[model samples]
Target chain A: MAPPKRSVPDSSANGGALSLPRQAGDQRRDPSDRAIAEACGRGEAWAMELIYHRYRRRVYGLASRIAGPEDADEVAQEAFVRILRGLPKFRGDAQLGTWIYRLAVNAALTHVTRRPRHTEGDEVLDNIPAAQTSARDPGLSARLERALVALPAGYRAVLVLHDIEGLSHEECATILECRVGTSKSQLHKARARMRELLGPALAAERKGE
Target chain B: MRCPQLQRLSSRFLDGDLGAERASAARGHLRDCERCQRAVAAEAEIVAAARSLPSSPEPAQGWDVLWGRVSARVAEEERADAARSAASLWWRENRSRLTLAVSAGAAFAFVLWGAPALPALGPGPLGLVPGSSSGGDQAVTEGGPERDGVGESLAERGARERAETDRQFREAVSELEVIIAEEQAFSDGARADAAGAELGAIRERVRGAKAARVALPDTAGRPSPRQDPVYEAYWEELATLQRAAVGVSDGEPGAGFRQDPAGRAPATGPVTGDDRGGDGPQGPGGARDSAGDGEGTR
Candidate 1:
C-alpha cells in the first residue's frame, strides 16, 4: 500500500525533525516511502533519521530476538546499513515494512551464525514481546521464550515469520528464500517442537478445559 | 494420490494451490481419517500458541548506533558513486576524440616501424635495370633510391638516366676521336684528312648530346610528356651513338664494329669499353674505334 499522506516538511524549510507539527491539510504533499528511500539514497541525514524513527524499535527488536543481546546492537547496525544501501533499488512491490523485516531477519541470522553464541541467561528473558503477555503468567511467557530460542534456525525462522509475525506461508517463503511448501513444512515442525516444550504449561491450561 | 502424497501436499492445499476437486477429496479424507484431523488441529494450535509470543523491546542505544553507522556508510558510498559518475561522464564526452587519437597513434607507429625497409619494397626506376649504365666506366647511378624511397624523385631518376646516355655517347665519340688521332699520327697520307673531318662530326654529336637534358617520371610516377629536353636528350644520344659507330667502322680498327649487327647496339647499350677492332662483340667503346680506322682509309 502507498504510505500515509502527510506532507514531508522540507528539512531545510523547518530544520528537519525539530520542526513543529503541521496543522491539518497543510498544502505541501507527503513524500512516500519511495521518496524517503530516494532521499536516503542521496545520503540525506533527515531521511535516514526518518527511517530510524519509523522502524527503529521493530528492527532492533527483531535483531535482539534472533541474535540475542550480545549481537543485537551489531545486527541492528548491519541491517540499517544494508537497508540504506538497498533503498535506491527498492521497488515498492512489497511493503517497506516487509522489506525492512527481511533485512533485519537476515542480519540477525548472519550475526548469530557468525558468532555462534548459545548463552541463554538474559536473552531468553528479554526476547518476549512487550504488550501481549502483560496479563499472562510471566512463567509461561518465560517458558515460551526458552522454547523458541532452542529451536533450529530454519524452524525458528518459519515460526517467527508465519505465526508470531502473522505472515502467510507465501510471505515466509519469500523472506526465507524457500518454496512455500518448505515454509509450511518448517512451520508444522516448529509448532510440533513448541508443543513438546510447552507440554506442561499447555497441560495446565488443558486441565481447566 | 495416496494418504502420504496428500499429507505432503497438505501445506500447498492450506496455502491454496490445490484445485477444487483435490481440495474436496482431501476434505473427504480428513472427515474419515481421525489421524489427519488431529494433525490439522495440532497445526492450528501451534500457530495460535506462536502468535501469542510477545514482541520484546530492543536495547535503547540500538537505533542511535545503527543510524550513525548507516549514515556514514551511505555517505561513503555516495562519494564513491559521485566519483564513478564523474569519470563516466568524462568518457562519454571524449570517447570519439580518444578513439581517433589511438588510431592515429597506431598508424604513426606502424609507419615509423616500417620506414626502414621501404626501398626493397619499391618498384625502382630505369637505373635499377642491370645494363643501364653499360656506356660509362663508372657505375652511372646518380641519386639512387634511399631506404626511405624519397632518395630520388622521378625527376632525379630522369636526370640520372639522361646523364648515363650523355656519358655513353661521349665515351663512344671520344673513342672515335682517339682512333682518328692515331691514324693522323701514323699517316702523312690522304686518308688522314678524311679521319679529321669525321672526328669533327663525332665531336658535334658529343656537343649535341651534352646540351640535351631529359625529364623523368613526375611525383605520381607517370612519365610526363611535357618535352623539356627529355625527348631531345634521347634523340641526341641515339644520333651521337649511331654517328660515332659509323665513323669508327670506316677507320683502321673497323673489324670490331663488324662483329655482328645485333652486337652493334649503341648509346643506352653502347659498346662496353673495348671499342677497338676485334676486341669482343660486347666491347665497350671498342666497336666505334674500328669506324675511325675505316674512316681514315676513306
Candidate 2:
C-alpha cells in the first residue's frame, strides 16, 4: 500500500500519542531495526521518521518525567538529534531502545542541571500539602504527581525509571550509567524519599481511612 | 536482622532486589514488627501509585509538532554536514600544494627583504668590537639619506649607497696591495721576522673582512671604498706591513700613507699582537708576496 507514507496525522488537536492506522502486515514490509539504524546513519528521512514514531512516547515520557513537562519538548528534540547523529557509531552492543533511553535520560539530566529548580528534599515538611483522608485514596494519584516533582533529580530519575516506567534495576543501571548495586540503592532511597514526600497521603492509604 | 536494619530493606523487598536469605529475614522482621510492616506497605503504595501515574500525558500538541521541529533541525544539520564534508575534501586534495606554495612564498620573501638588512647590522653583539651594535645602529639611523617624500625609504637608499662604497673599497685595497708588493724592500734579520709575524695577523683580519663582503646578498648596500670603516682598519695594518716590507720606519712616508703616531695600529679595534703571535711562519717577503697574490686573485 504505497509503503504507507512516512507521515504523521495532523494530531496537533489530539492530546495523546499517535495511533498507527496502517493495515496489518505493515510490520512485515518494514525494515529491521538494524537496517533502520543504518538508514538513519545514512541521513535517510524515512528511517528517522520511523524511529521517531517508534520511540516518541517513551522518549517524551522519560524526558517529561526527568526534566519536567515544560522542558520535555526541547529535551526530547535534543535527544532525538543525538540519537540520529550517534546512530553511525551504534555498535549494537545494547538494544537500540535501551541505547535511545540512555541518550534521552542523559539529555534530560543535562537539561535539569542547566536549569536549577527547588526539589522536594529542599522543601520544609510543614510546606507539604496535607493528604486528604479517603478509603479509596481519592487524590493519591494527583498528590503523588506533585510529590514526584518535589523529589531531587537523582531520586526522581531512579523512581521514574524503576517505579513509574517499570524498568528492572539492571536496565535502570544501563540507562543511568550506574552499577546495579548503585541503582538498587538509589531506588531504595528514591522510594523512601517518595514515601516521605507522600507522608500523610501514604499514611492515610495504609490506614485505609 | 533488627527492625531498623530490616526497615531499610523494605524498598528492596518490594522490588524483589533482596536475596532469598535477606528476603526471608526481612519477612520475619515485618511479621513481628507492626511499625516496620506499615513502613514497607507505605513504600509499596508509593511505588504502585507512581506506576499508576499517567504515562506523561501526551504533549498537548501531540507528536506532529515535535516531528516538524526535529525534522527541520535534522535537515539543517545535514546541510551543515554536507558543507563541512565538501570543505574537508577540498583541503585534503590540495594540502600538499598549499603547503609547498606557502613555504616557497615565505622563502622568496625572506631572500628579497630579510637578507639585505644583514650586511648593515655588522657582526651583531657577538662581534669582537664592543661598540659594533651601537655603531651599526648609528650607521643605519645617521647615514640614512633624506626620504624626499617618495616610495623609497631613507634606509633603502642608505643601503644602496653603502653597497657602492663597499665595491669601491674592495677595488682600492686590491690596488694598494699591488703597489706594496712592487715596493719590495724587506728588512734584514729579526726586525723583518717580527714585522712578518704582525703582517700575517693583519692579513687574517683582511681575509675575514673579504669573506664577510662575499657573504652579503646582492641587494645589501655597499659603502664607499675609501670610507668603508672595516676595510679602512685592514688598510691601516696593510700600510704598516708594507712599510716593513719596504724597510721604512714609523717617521717615513711608506706606500704614500703617513703612519699614525701609534705606529701603524688601526684606529678601530682590529687584530692585535696577542691574536696574531706565533700563528704562522712568515718573512717580510712571505707577507708581501701573499698580499700581492690576494690582490691578483681579486
Candidate 3:
C-alpha cells in the first residue's frame, strides 16, 4: 500500500498567534515563516507548529486544485513532512511559501497518480464553514475547483501557482523546474482549457457584475 | 497578417509576454482579423478567471499533527545517516589487520606447495665424507667398509705400501729439479733474444697514461710533453736490467728447494750448462741466432 497521507491542521483556529517571534533585522521579515523554517531545520517543536500554521491553508488549496478536496489534507501534511526533511538543504533561494506550495503540488500529484481512481469525496473538505457556502457563491468556487481538477497535473500546477497564488512566471518556473517560456506556455494552455470548462458560469458571472 | 503567426503570438499576448513590437503587430493583425480577435478575447477571459478563483478553506487537522509526521521523518533520516557513518568507520579501522592476515596466509601457502624440489645428497656417487684429508691413515677407515670385509683388507695393504712409495717420490723430485734447471737456461736465452718486449709493454702503458692525461686537459696545472719513443725504450731497458739483478739476489741457494724422503741420502751430480751455450752472455751474435731460429720463444 502507498504511505498514508499526512493530516495538516486548520490554520484559522490558531489565528496569527502561532507566528514566529520577530527578528530585529533590516530585511522585510515574515517572522512566523522564518521561525518555522529554522525550527524545522533544527527539528524544533514550536518551529514545526508555526510552519504548519503558516502554510497549511496555502498548501491545502494547492493540493485541492491538483488532487481534489478529498486528498488535499493528506497531501498537505506529506508536503510539510517533505519540507521538514529538506529544510536543512533549503538555501532560501526562493520564498519559503513558494517552496512549500511546490512541495504540496508535487505531493498531491503523486497521490493522484498512485491511486488514479480515487475521487474528491473520499475525504471531507475540512474546516469549510456552512455560512461561507451560502454567503458567497460556494457553487462558483466548487465549479472552479472541479474545472481545475479536470485539467492535467502539469497544467493544474501551473494554473494554481501562476493564477490563484499570484506567483510570477519565473517563480512558477522555479517551482515546476522549467524555463519561464515553458511556464508561460503551460499557464496559457491551462487557462484556455479552464475557460472552456467554466465558460457558462464565467459568462453569467460577468453579465451579473 | 499571417493566420498561423497571429495564432502563435495570441498565446504570448494573452500572458502579457509578447514583446512590444510583436504585441503591437498582433494587436494590429487582430483589429483587421475578426476570427483571431475572438480567440484572443476568449484566452484573456480564461487567464482572468483562473487568477480570480477563490482559495480553498483550511483543513480541520491543525499544526500539531503535521509537525509530528515531519519530526518522525527527520529523525528516521538522521538515524540512517548515523548508522552508515558507523559502518564506514568500522571498515576503515579493520582494513589494515584484514590485509595483514591475507598476506600471511598467502606466504604460508607458498611454503607448503610452491617450494622447489631439493637435490638428494646420500652416500653415493659424488658423496662427500667429512674430515677426509690426503696422507691421513684414517681416510680408508672413515668411509664405510664393504660387508664382505674385502674393503678392510685393501685399506690395510694401502697403509703398508707407503715406504716404497716414498723412495719413488724422491727420485721423481730429483729428475724434476734437473728439468727445471735446463728450462731456466732456455728461458735466459729467450730473454736475450726478445731484447726489448717487456720494456716495450712498459713503454706502451706509460705512453697511454701520458696521452690520457693530456686529453683530460689538466684543470690543476699544465703537464710537460711526453718523451720520444726511442728515449722511452732506453729508460725501459735500464729498468729491465735492474729488475733482473733483483731477481738473481732473491733466488739464492735452497730458496726453491722442497723436502726429500727421511731415509734418502743427499744426491749430487755435474751441473750441465751445455743447453745454455747458443744464447750465452758472451755477445749479441748469440742473441741474434736465438731470435732468428725462434728456439727460445718466450
Candidate 4:
C-alpha cells in the first residue's frame, strides 16, 4: 500500500542515470527511481527485492573489482543490508540508484581496507560464487582484476566507478565522498599502480591475443 | 607539450574530461610520445576488460536456500524493531514517571560522585565536627562504631567494595546471557547446513563461538570474581545462545546449557558437552567453579 507519486530525480547531483528498477508491465513507463524508492519506503516487499534484482550485477561488479571475487558476495550482501535498512528513510535528494552505488562502493572499499593481505590465485578462486562468463577476453579480464585489487581502497573505488563502471569523475566523487579534483588525482595514481601491477600480465595478454 | 604535462592530462584524456583545446594538444603530443600512447591504451584496456568480466549472478542453489536465511534475518530484524517499539511505547506512556525517576537517578548519581566533594552533603572532609568547633576532634570521634569493633571508615570501605562487586556481577551476567543465546543460534544454523564449503563456514563460526566462550575466566558461577571484559563477552555470548535457541526449537532450548530458569547464571554447561547441562548451573558454587574451570580450559 505504498503511495507512489511523481518526483523528479536530480541526475546532475549524481552525474547520470544508473539502471534503477522500473515497475513492470503497464506500470513501467511512469515509475521513476524516486517512485520506486518511495514505494520501498512505504514497506512494499516487491520494491525491496526489485532494488536487489536491479542492482545485483552492478553491486557485484563494483565489489568484485575492488574487494576481489572471494569477498565480493559478502560485500554485496553488506551493501544490500545497508540499502534495505537505509531505504526506509530515504529522502529523494539524489537518484535512488546513485545512493545504492554509493552504498556498494563504500561497502567494497571497507572490505578491501579490512583485509589488506587478500592473496590471489587458485585457492582464492575456489571460494568465489557462481559467475557467468560475459568476458570476451578472459585473459585480459583476469589481469585487470589482479591489478585493480592492488590499488589503495580509496583509489580502487574511484577507478572502479570511473574507469570500470564508466561513471564520470563527478559521479565518482559523489560516490566516494571526495572532491572532483581528488577523484581525478586518485584515478591518476590508480592507473599508475595498475600499470605497475599489470605490466607483465598486460604483455602476456597482448602476446596471447 | 612536455611528457609530464601530457601525463597529468592522461586520465582526463582517457575519461575525455579535458577541455577541447587541451585534449587536442594531448592528442598531438600522444602522436609523438609512444610511451604516453601505450599508457593511454593500457588505461582503455583495463576499463574494457573490467567491464567484460562475467557478472557474479546470485548462485541458483544458494539463492532459494539463502533466501530462507534472508527471510529469517528480516523476521529477526522485525522482531527487534517490535521490541524497540514496545520500549518506545513504554517510555511514552510512562514519561512523567520516567522523568521523576530520572530526576531521582540524577540526584542519586550526584550523591555518589558529588558527595565526597561537598562538605554539606556527604562523608566528612577528615576535619570537621558536626556541631562544635572547639570540640571538633572529640565530636567527630563520638558515637562512632562502639559495638562492631570496626571503624565507620572501614565499614564504609567494605560497603563500597560490596556495591562495586554487585554492579560487576550484574554486567557479567547480562553479557553471558547474550553469548549463550548466540551459541544456540549457531548450533541451529550448523544443523541446517548442506555439505561442501557452506558447512566449512558454519564450522568456522562454531569454532569462533567456542573461542568466545574460552574468554570466560573460569569463575564458574562464583559471583564474578572480577569485572573483566572477557567475562562480559562470554555472558553476552550466552544471551545470544538463548535467542538463537528460541528461533530454532520449541522443546527445551537454552535449558540444555543454562540450568537456571530465572537466568541467574553463575553457570556452566557440563565440562564434556558444550551444549548439555547436569548440575553445573545449580551445583554447589565452589564445585561448579572447579568443574567450570576445567571446561573453560578445553
The fraction of correct interface contacts reproduced by each prediction comes to: 0.31, 0.37, 0.36, 0.20
Model 4 TM-score is 0.49
- lDDT score at residue A76, model 3, on the 0-100 scale: 71
Instruction: Name the regions of candidate 4 deviating beyond 4 angstroms.
Output: A1-35, A120-137, A204-209, B54-68, B85-298
DockQ of each: 0.11, 0.14, 0.13, 0.16
Candidate 3 positional error at B298, Å: 99
Model 4 Cα shift for residue A133 (angstroms): 20
Q: Which lDDT tens digits does candidate 1 get at residues B1-298? A: 4577666655555546578899888888888887677555544444444556665566666445667776776677557545432222222222223222322322332332233334543345422422222111122333343222555533344445445544544554465556556656765624445545655765665555355422222222322222223333333333333333333332233222221111122222222111211112211101121222222221
Top-lDDT structure, candidate number: 2
lDDT of each: 0.49, 0.55, 0.47, 0.48
Better of 2 and 4 by TM-score: 2
List of chain B TM-scores, one per candidate: 0.28, 0.28, 0.27, 0.29
**Which is better, 1 or 2, measured by lDDT?**
2
Score every model by TM-score: 0.43, 0.52, 0.45, 0.49
Q: Is candidate 1 or candidate 3 better by TM-score?
A: 3
Model 2: fraction of the reference interface contacts it also forms: 0.37
Q: What 10-residue stretch in candidate 3 chain B is worst by lDDT?
A: B264-273
Worst 10 contiguous positions by lDDT, candidate 4 chain B: B277-286
After superposing candidate 3 on the true structure, give the runs of residues whose Cα lies further than 4 Å from its correct spot. A1-15, A19-38, A117-141, A199-209, B61-298
Report the CA-based lDDT of candidate 2 relative to the real structure: 0.55
Query: Model 2 in CAPRI terms: which quality?
Result: incorrect
